[model samples]
Target chain A: MLSIPIEYYLILSAFMFIVGVTGVLIRRNAIVVFMCIELMLNAANLSLVAFSSYHGNPVGQIFVFFVMTVAAAEATVGLAIIIAIFRNKLTVNVDEINIFKW
Target chain B: MNIELILFIILATIAAVTSILVITRSNAVISAVFLVLNFFALAGLYLLLNAQFISVVQIIVYAGAIMVLFLFVIMLLRTDGEPRIFSDKRYIKYFALLISIFVFIQVSYLLLIGSPSKSVTGNQSASINSGTIETIGKELYTNYIIPFEVAGFLLLAATIGAIILAKKKFE
Candidate 1:
């Protein structure tokens, strides 16, 4: 079986992160952007897990667990805020919900 | 190409295609499902790297729980079908693509230029050979206990916050 090197995982992470950056930049919907942010986080998590496995220590994997937990929390709080904003503004575009500019 | 490289390419293609579908499709439901495909592809890649625990977690947490939440929100908010044209930042779109290409080039350069380094101690794929779940459990409880507990607390706070945020205002 062909096994990919650790570097390949890093490269994949880089690609996914870039895709996520573009998703955030191009998309108008705040929800899609938020999901893209999650994608970026997951890309980094993939790299961390790969590194930990390559090094045979559980530290990177442990850190990834922490990252996942944080991501979940972020998703919850973020979605809640989005919902609140949507209820108020009647739209979820990043360009429109600028009430906190003061 | 060799089997490993071939498999990597296949998986990479799948992930890339699904991710593009996720981002480009106007329908929120289709996009969410494509994101699930992307996650599953990533989990497969993780398995290739021998991070079995991480792979399973990726499938369970991301593909299972998180996406379910996204679907729930999308349906609850009635945000299906084509997304509306909210922004006209055409210049920023081009800029983002250019930057992504630059980053991809830089990473490819590094990968091509980098030398193969040997593994560190206790990680030579020989020193400690065990299943991913067992090894991760031993390490998480023994060495990384504090962070684990902190993460748990963080999740609890987030759960409460989400409930507070999403609850209907039925006065």
Candidate 2:
């Protein structure tokens, strides 16, 4: 067995996903949290590629490409929304962004 | 332990730690920069997994394009310094902490309780070592035509949506 099992990569991805989740939850800054979400997405991508490699399949690798493209689009839209929020409230705190909060 | 295994562990730890820093740090710019570092480490992990195309694209799209745009917007907005972001929401910090712990537990359980046996040989590909960008390009345009087109359409919509949202206030 390779010292690093495929499971190891899976575990690493899981840890990263947890960390990203924590970052999203703990950070009040919208940008920080936004980056955290990106972190989570990348974690998922890492596992997908790792699993694909372990399986010796090209499908998962291709899926990673799709995920990357979507991530790019999501980041663009998300950052633009952040910009709009900044314009309206002059702040990027999720708490202060109570314009629509019920 | 093999070199790849050791390197993965070290890099994974670094990525996780820096990601924590990226979120906990008060400075928005610093957080953004750390996110870039996190992406680079992820790309490195992708490299170790033998997903050369994914790794290159990870760097190009994430570390290069997306992160630069994020930094640009953050800097352009001038919201780097603290100016009363979540000062009033005192409970939010605790709430976030709880959520993170919950997620960690959930994922740990799923991993532990799920299948421990590794599958033998369902993933062997004839073109693994030899297939390059040329093959990927051909496959993307051929067998993966529908999903590829759908992804392109999604990008177009996201682009239009972003432009509309960003330009709405001015008009």
Candidate 3:
């Protein structure tokens, strides 16, 4: 009975999270940055589900459910902000949106 | 390797590769598509993990709804052929990459070196039932009612906020 170790799922989660971090750092497009954020959230959800099933508890899964809801709300509001900025600035590059950089 | 292991390996590969593609693709639309693929792979992995409901939510809420919102925003932004800004501040990229790789090494090192006991292995039937809709519904209604109502309020606030934020001018 060689079940897949919890560490494997965690390793996968770590890899995705790192890739997401790299994206957030390197990419300038606001939308791309938003996608990277989703990637990070998904990575966290993966580990939560892994641990939930690993420990035979439903609490982690419930947490994942809350995370998903929050993610949805965050995406809508964040994108709307991006849209507002684009309407005014005519750009979504992170480097160029420097109104608050003072 | 058993069927679950084989499935896990395949889905994990898909998830890993698509996530990389999602981040690296030059065009935002292309990145969105790759992200959808990545979500599907993750949904499969969730199924393998015995979280049937979460897996479906991963597809419907994530792949179906959230990614659609992402794609819509990308199209609305019309940011095609935005020149790459990676030419300047090249060292910051390297710095972030270094930090990420370093953290990953630390985590993996801990996981490999630590001999966490195997006694935490869960009962199969219980784990399966734990992920079911019925079990989750009961738990959510009984023990997690406050959080559930709060999430609903949160969604309502988000909807109004999005509408207000997207409005062209304040009335």
* Top-TM-score candidate index: 3
Report the CAPRI category for model 3: medium
Q: Write the per-residue lDDT of candidate 1 for residues B51-134, one digit (tens) a residue.
A: 778789989998998888887777767553444433445677778889888988887788667733333222446313432788
lDDT of 2 by residue, A46-70 (tens): 8787767766667777887898889
The regions of model 2 sitting more than 4 angstroms off are: A1-3, B80-92, B113-117, B120-127, B130-135, B168-171
- Candidate 3 clashes between residue pairs 3 or more apart in a chain or in different chains: none
Residue A11 lDDT (model 2): 75
RMSD of 1: 3.0
DockQ of 2: 0.57
Task: Please give the distance, in angstroms, between residue A13's alpha carbon in candidate 1 and its true position after superposition.
Answer: 1.5
Candidate that scores best on DockQ:
3
**Range of the 10 consecutive residues with the lowest summed lDDT in candidate 2 chain B:** B122-131
Which of the two, 1 or 3, has more TM-score?
3
List residue ranges in candidate 3 displaced over 4 A.
Answer: B82-89, B115-119
Provide chain B's TM-score, model 2.
0.81
> DockQ rank, highest first?
3, 2, 1
lDDT of 3 by residue, B16-91 (tens): 9998887777889999999999999999998888899999999999999999999999887779554554545578
